[model samples]
Target chain A: MTTPGLTQVLLAGILVVIAIAVARYWRLPVIKDMAFGSVRGFVQLVAVGYAVRFIFDIESPWLIMLALGIMMTVGAHAASGRVKSVKGSFGTCLAAILTGSLITLATMLVFKIISFDARYIIPLAGMIIGNSMNASALVIDRLASDLRANRLAIETALALGKSWREASQKFHRDAARTGMVAMLNFLKTVGIVALPGAMTGMILAGADPVEAVLLQVIVAYMLLSATTITSVVAVELTIRRFFTRHHQLRIDR
Target chain B: MAVTGSILELCNLTRRVGDGTPARAIVDNFSYSFGFGRLYSIIGPSGAGKSSLLRLLNRLDECTDGSVKFKGSDTREFAPCELRQRLGYLFQTPHLFDRTVRDNIVDAQPHLSESKISRLIQQVQLPSGIVDAPVDNLSVGERQRVALARLLATQPEVALLDEPTAALDPANTEAIERLISSVVTDHGVTVVMVSHSRQQVVRLGGEAILMVDGQLIEHGDAVGLVKNPGTPQGRRYMNGEPQ
Candidate 1:
């Protein structure tokens, strides 16, 4: 299979126009978002494609490390934007995303499943960082909202002599599961429901089907580990914001 | 009333909110000493910091200024978990865990035996066999009773009741009132209840404290204080006038 040229890309842009037209015809409020998002997505992806290709050509370890750092920081910022309930959450999100993605990437490298080459490392790390970002955001948002909504239940436990950790143990499990639910669903319904992105991209690039399947399997495991780690760390940090050192609920903060 | 030392004391306890030039005190400079084995009803109109004061006592909400002493030591000295066990709190609306009635009761004291739980059920006047029933099936009043039983299972030195009967019907209210009286009478636990109803305050027949704008306005015998308040704020509160 040959790579698509600018003409093929121009043809794909027509779908965005069709989506915006449909949204306008239905008087949906998201017409502006659709148009703006399509344009922004195009610009961002093109920029990133050029950047990744540049790094891949150079294959400098420092540039690769710098690229990973930029991706994790941007991912953490995006994740923090989604969790508005907690203040000063950017640091927590950054730490969680860093820990999660780094641990998973290190494990993959240590096992020699993937080389240090930017071609393999950058894309895989991007996947891991992106997924970890989402997991961190979901965990923080769910836990914060759950803690707020269940104030009576949590305070009742505290009033009954339970520690803050004890009072919120159930919510911690709930938020962690919520963070991991997406990966779990992917694992459960992979191939049958839909061919996942990495596997499909590999197949589209003319890789053997079995090899793509194997790589997809590794990606799934990588996401599961990253998401679990991110979720646990996010929960640890977020839950502390709702309770004081005295074990009192400080949801106002 | 017992002449023994106070089990719980509030020393200029205050809780303020907001980040303005002068933060508003939800509970301001409130001080009181609660004796062992007595019922004290804190009375006030809405927004008078009745509930806030109760929360401060249990350290569910931290104090902005001053301190709470549980048995003569500042509450900050003890681990909050251990402190709360000795000062069990019941919220205005009971929040029973979604579990069996017995399970809710045993939550405060996990090792509570079947016989002890039955005694608590009897003490709280809940029907027999209701213990095994899921709390979802119980009415709000019964749930309140279950919450009370759970508080009782801790065997607290002082039980903080924040309008525990506020949501109940008159019959349920009377049942809860009776159980509350028994908590002090039968178990010798000090009771500090926040009440909105003047009639209910009189009915409970203990020491009544009137608070206005987060300050202690007056305190006296429950029946007398409700009948003839000593302060202007107390009078306005008793007469249902906006303070």
Candidate 2:
């Protein structure tokens, strides 16, 4: 039985305090969900840590790809639930999440900065997939909210013989616009404002300055690709499902 | 009299929706016709398919077993947007757009003459000042009127309203009832409205369509239905007695 280090234990404690303070300050209704989500995240990371240790040493490239597949699937699932309320566009979440993860993951692997092993593969996959999940969810949630908010305009468009896609175009655009903000910020502030965990870890492991910078650049660029793909795909696919064959909204009449 | 119509028509219509529990197959083997320049009030319980039948005209929900023919053409035959442009439907609780009232109406039919739009706003009896107001700033009555104005802007040959006054005060209710009459008579738009209130049915001055458990029990002559309802459900509805 391997015991966690003192720093690891302290970090967990600090995370709990941070979560509690944030929830209280934001007036979050579900403190329990926040706590459970945080705890579950930490537990998952720990399990992945050991699993990556074994996989990285196994000398099997397929397992590396398998980890990426798993990451994309989970991200897609998260995106689906987040955008389920969006009419017609729920199916779009899968495409967005998977596409986003693939573009980001592919670019990183091709660049050879992180190396094609589970140690880097799993962690990096986790980060890109996690970001894709959030971005796709935001796209779906924002589209649904905007559609409901602009129900009159949409209905009027439908009444005017506009296809469902045409009616919901504004909503899709607005949602995509709002969802991309986070990814855009990450793109703008990648080097000067913050050092992502992966590059920092490599630096601490005695990697050269050029290598760390190269790795960071690849990660930043890939994340941008993934999030952009997600935002676009989710909105387009979801908007398609929102209307009937006659170009009317498939809402309760 | 069984009304003959080219405004809105339901021919051999039967509707089934969902899959048990969440599934509802309330309307079955029913046919009705609505004519131009006539106002129709449909009164029934929650699952009576009053709303479902109205939706058939807009193709929002389909009839499982029969065809809904509008103006002698199958609803499926018309392009949804094209058909809907000439057919307006309003929800019980109006879902107002988050924009100014002018945009809400004019944006739907951008090419419509400005004079017709001003006439529609005036016809709905909405104040001139409310036309530029944001949808969120308006009261429930105001929202419903704006929604109605938007619908009318499409120049619909038929107007389908699902309990348009469900969320309004009595003053607003009377205003909407008056608006319904004004539209049907003036614009020659056929009206099909769902109402749970018998008073609204009486006040709106239309053929009373008494529906119960998704079947039409009584149709035609609102005064006659109230005076001597042929079906038990119709009598119960008129008497305000539990069915």
Candidate 3:
């Protein structure tokens, strides 16, 4: 269920108007891209809402499971291409995104923190899936840029017959840290400085305020955990692709 | 004929592209070595693994599985950067970064000053005006010089150039030849060039390694191979006979 409160609508409208104004004033090249993105977001969200309603009516667990698997695969591929650092390494990425998000979703639903329904499952998955994609992309891109810039140091380590992990050890930690920072910031401001959409929706729908607070706490924790796991998995797999068993980068011609 | 050692041995080093699904070896089973202070050129037909072989020296392509030793050390053991530092590479087509021509030359060592830059730029015979100009604005030959200057800047012990004179005008080609001759004479850089021109290799005068179907078929003194290539590989390729 999409939230339809006055505050939410007003905030969104203001964001759009501000975005246009900023683009115009700064002569930004991405004004069209921004507008196009917003329009696509609206259409996709609307379509997903309708699609979830139909799935909820079917009440088939297998179908729900299939839906989740498809979401993870598509999300992983999109995220892979989105950043040069990760460079489309999908096998590990798909596993990470799916396992992390689904496990978190399952635990929350069984605990009654979030009700077990398609409406909740689909939306929670969307939120977790979107953020996981972003964090993984950041992690992969950071690793790539780091690798590209310091290839000399990496090769020096390799020439000494060091393994891929040993060669890129310095970069691995930094790239993971950068990706984790966003999740950390989200955790810090979960309640005090901001009211998240899921929590606000529950509160507006007249659930007991305490229950809503507890539910939102679970959501925040799940998002943080899922994003962290996905980011780490993305970085490690991406770095391994940078070399081969013979300790060489298979450069594309 | 002066055939060099199996310093770097390749039993069946092949590199096949197009997903190399089964990992086919296009630059197949190439066995050769870096003889001390000796120059060599890997000449072959189009689609041959000439460039791929050059890249293999630096492990730019991990598909090269066989051994490429250097000074009794297994090439596989040396780090890619270390291998590359000892061997300079000039791409078939010249390309510079999105900065000034001088910056492209200084890419290998960014801390170079105006005086050092001018000397190298002059050595490559680039006009002084080309330094400040945008790299993208230069002709292909000018870009080649910049790439050559950058290679020299790295102070590599071996220079591997893929079609170094392919895109040049006659004048530019002659200047590049002179630059290569001087670099070899003064810098003592072991040069391995991939050239189709018999005339150019004759001008440069060194050893020759001929490849076909990813295999090294003939390698000997350049003068000897060009005059009377004993192997079927040398005679057929030089005669331009239909395969």
Candidate 4:
């Protein structure tokens, strides 16, 4: 199968026009978002595509690491925006995402399942970083809200001589689970509900169906590990903000 | 009524809330000494910082200035969890874990034996069968009793009762009052209860501290303080006069 050219991409513009027309007809408030989102997505993806192509051509490990670092920093910044109510959220997100993505990628490289080549690492890093970013954000947001909402329960536990970790144990589990729920659901209903992006992209690029399935399996496992690590790290960091060294619930933030 | 040596002492305890210029003091320069094997009731109108003072005693909220000494040592010296264990606090609204009554009690003392759990149930005057019952199945009164049992399971030297019966019916209230009295007499647990009801303090019959707007207005024998307050503000409060 041949890659789609600029002419074929121009044809996709008709779909965006149709969506904007429908929004206009319905007088929806999201008309501006829809129109702006189309342009922004186009620009962002095109820029990323060029950047990835340049990184892949370089074939230097340092350049690959630099690209991954940039991706993680941007992902952390985006994740932190979702949890603006918590202090030090950016640092928390950065640490969690970096730890999760790097650990999973390192494991894959060590096992020789994936090579150090940028062609494999760059795209794989993108997927792991993206999933870790979302997981980190969800964990932080849910934990903050749950801790604030259940101050009475938490304080009661602390008053009963429980450590801060023990006092917020329930909330920590809940927040971590909240972050992983999406990935778990995706695992449960991946092919039956919808073919995931990596598998579909592979199939569209004319890879053998069996090979695509195998690669998708690896992607799923990588995500599960990344998200689990990210969620746990996020909870560990975020829970500290709500509590003091004295086991007191300090939600001044 | 003469009491022995103090168990908990608060010296110039103050808690200021807010970050703006001139932060407001919720508990302003409060000082008190609570004796062991005795019950003390803190009576005050709404927003008198009675609850705030209790929180400070437990170190649930930090004091901006001053210190709380448990058994003559600064609270900071002991680990916070260890201090809280020794000084148990019960909230106005009971917060039981979403599990069986037995689990709630066992949460405080995880290694508690079955016989001990049953003993705690009986100590709180709760029905023995309620132990296996889910906390969600229990009424507000039952929940409060379970909470008290949980508080006692920690074997705290002092119990900070923050309106333990606030949500209970008159019958439940009477039962809880009896339990409070028994805990003091039987276990010799020091209790510092915060209550808005003047009559409850009189009925509890111990030392009483009256607070208004973050200041201790008056304190004496409960019945005496309620019947004939020394200060004009205390007298007006007893008379139900608006401030």
Candidate 5:
């Protein structure tokens, strides 16, 4: 397959035009979001493509680490932005994403499955950071909402001598599950339902099919590890905010 | 668990809520002392901080000013879990865990013996067979009884009830009122209940503290306070008129 150029990319713009037209004709509320999102996505991805190219060219260890730090920060900010009820969640998101991505990346490097090179570490870390960011956000959002919604039940438990952790134990499980559910479903339905983006991209880039499949398998496990860690960490941090040192539920907070 | 002096004391208790704008005190400078093995009903209209004061007692909501003393010591000195265990709270609409009634009671006091659990169930006037029944299947009145039994299982020195019978019918209300009275008279648990109904207050008949805008309006015998309030605010509140 030949590499797609600017002309090919311009042709893809037609799809966005069609989507926006349909949204306008239907009088949908998403028209503005659709238009802005499409434009924003193009600009962001283009910027990322250039940045990745530059990072790959440099191949400096310090540069690679710096790039990962920037990516995680941006990812954390975006993740925290999605959650409204939680206060001081940016720190939680940052800590979770950093822990998840670093641990997963370190495992891959230590096992020599992926070398500590920019070409490998940067792309894989990007995937881990992206997924972990989402998982952290989901965990915080779900846990905060669940805690608020079940205030009476939790307070009842607290009033009966249960600690904060004991009172919100069920919610911890639920929020962690919410964070991981998407990845879990993806793992269950990966090959049979649809080819995942990474695998598909590798295949489209003319990599051998079996090699791509193996890489995809590794990617799957990497994501599972990252998201599990991220979800658990997010829950640990988020649940603390809803309770006081005295184990009382701070419902208003 | 012998009867002594005041089991719970509120000293200038206050809770203020709000952001940038002026913080309004929800439970403002309220002071009272609840005696042992007695029933005390906190009577007030809506937003009078009846429930707020109950919350402050158990440290469910932090007091912005003043303190709550449990057994002659500031409540903060004890671990919150221990404090809550000793001072059991029942909400207006009881929230029973999604489990069998027995499990709900056990959840409160894990070490409660089978016979003790049975007695608690009986004390709350719930049918013996209802122990193994799922709380989801029970009526609201039955759930309230289960919650009461759960509170009793803790063997708390003080039972802080927040409108325990607001959701119950007249029959259920009377049944709960009786159970509450028995908790004090028989079990020796000091009951501080928040009741919207003036009639319920008279029926409980221990002491009634009338709160208006988070301040104590007047407090005296439940019968006297409900039947013949001393202050204008108390009189207006008893008559169901705006204060």
Candidate 6:
């Protein structure tokens, strides 16, 4: 298969135009968002493509690490926006995504599953950070809402001599599960229901099917580890915001 | 009513819900002392902060402008969990864990023996078979009993009951009142209960503290306070006037 030219890429504009037209004709409220989102996505991806190309050319470990850091920070910011109800959500998202992405990437390097090359590390880190961001956001959002809604049950347990951790244990487990449910579903239906993005992209780019499958397996494992770590960390961090050192629920914020 | 040694004391204990000039003080400048091994009933109209004061005693809600002392020590001195264990609180609406009655009790006191669990069931006047039943399957009254059992399982020195019988029918209310009496007489637990009904307060027959608009309007013997209130606010409350 040959690489598509810029003209071919611009041809995809027809799909966006069709979507915007349908949205307008239906008088949907999100027509503005759809139009703006299409433009923003196009700009952001094009910018990232250039940045990744430059970083790959450098092949410096320091530069690669810096790029990964930038990606995680941006991802954290985006994730934090999803949970507007939580205070200090940016810090929680950053910590969780950092912990999740770095640990998974470090493990892959140590185990020689992937090298420290910019080509492999950059793409892999992007995948881990993306998944981790979603996990952290989901965990924090669910935990905060659950704690707020069930203040009576939680306070009753706390008043019954249970520690803060014990009082919110069920919500923590539930929030963590909420974060991972999407990933779990993805894993369960990976190839049968839909071919995952990485494998499909690799196959479409003329890679051997067997090799693409092997790489997809690695991506799956990487995402699972990242999402799990991010979810647990997010729960731990987010729950602290709702409790005081005295084990009281602080929901006023 | 006796001026015996006190188990808990509230020194101008106050809680404010919001912030602004003239903040809304739920329990304002409230000072009182509860004696050991006695049931004290707090009667007030709705929004009079009876439950707010009870929550402050256990540090369930922080005091905005005062302090609570338990056993001659500031309540803040104790770890909140340890203090709560020592001073258990039963919410008006009993929130039992989504589990069996036995599990709810055990969760409160993990090392509780089977015999003790059975005794708690008996003490709360719950049927023996109810111990094995799921909490969702129990009636509201039964759930309250289970909550009481759970509170007892903690072995608290003081029990703060926020309208423990508010949602119950007369029979269940009487039964819980009997349990409260037994809790004080048999176990020597200090009880602080919040009730809107003046009759229930008199029937419980303890010291009654009448609060109106977050201030203590009057306090004296429960029967005397109901029969003859010292303040106009208390009298109006007894007359069923809107606060």
Candidate 4 Cα lDDT to native: 0.92
| Docking outcome class, model 4 | high
Instruction: Report the candidate with higher DockQ, 3 versus 6.
Output: 6
Q: Clashing residue pairs, candidate 2?
A: A88-A241, A88-A242, A89-A238, A161-B81, A246-B80
- Residues B67-90 of candidate 4: C-alpha lDDT, one tens digit per residue: 988888888888999989899999
lDDT of 5 at B1: 35
Candidate 5: regions farther than 4 A off? A14-40, B1-4, B20-22
TM-score of the B chain in model 1?
A: 0.97
Write the residue-wise lDDT of candidate 2 on B82-191 in tens digits: 77777788888776656898887877778767777788789888877777788889889988998898888888888889899999999999999988998888777888
What is the lDDT, from 0 to 100, of the residue B47 in candidate 5? 91
lDDT of 5 by residue, B1-243 (tens): 332377888899999998846699999998889988899988888999989899889888889999988878888888989989899899988889888998898888888899998888888888899999988899989988988888888889998999888898999999988888888898788999998888888888999999999999999999998999999998898788999
**Segments of candidate 2 deviating more than 4 angstroms:** A1-67, A74-94, A104-126, A137-162, A170-181, A185-193, A207-214, A238-253, B1-5, B21-23
TM-score of chain A of each: 0.96, 0.78, 0.80, 0.98, 0.95, 0.96
What CA root-mean-square deviation does each model show from the true structure? 2.1, 5.8, 9.9, 2.3, 2.1, 2.4
Tens-digit lDDT track of model 3 for B1-243: 223453334445666667656775678877666665567777777766787787776565665366666666666676666566566777777656668987766656667888888888898998877788998788888888988887777777778788899989999999998888888788777788899888777777888888887778888888788778988867888888744
lDDT of 4 by residue, A1-253 (tens): 5588877778888999999999899998998899889899989999989998998888999999899999999999999999998999999999999989989999999999999999999999999999999999999999999998998999999999999999999899999999899999999999999999999999999999889999999999999999999999999989988888888998762
Docking class of 2: acceptable
Model 1 earns a TM-score of 0.96
CA RMSD (A), model 6: 2.4
After the best TM-score superposition of candidate 3, give how far the Cα of residue A175 lies from its true spot, in angstroms: 13
Better of 3 and 5 by TM-score: 5
Q: What are the per-residue Cα lDDT tens digits for candidate 1 across B2-100?
A: 323888888899989999879999899998888889999999988889999988888888899998877778889888899899999999888888889
User: In model 6, which residue pairs have backbone atoms overlapping below 3 Å?
Assistant: none
Q: Each candidate's interface RMSD, rounded to one decimal?
A: 0.6, 2.8, 7.2, 0.5, 0.6, 0.7
Clashing pairs in 3: A159-B78, A159-B79, B13-B29, B14-B25, B14-B28, B15-B25, B15-B26, B16-B26, B20-B23
Tens digits of per-residue lDDT, candidate 6, B1-35, equal 33337889889888888877788888999999899
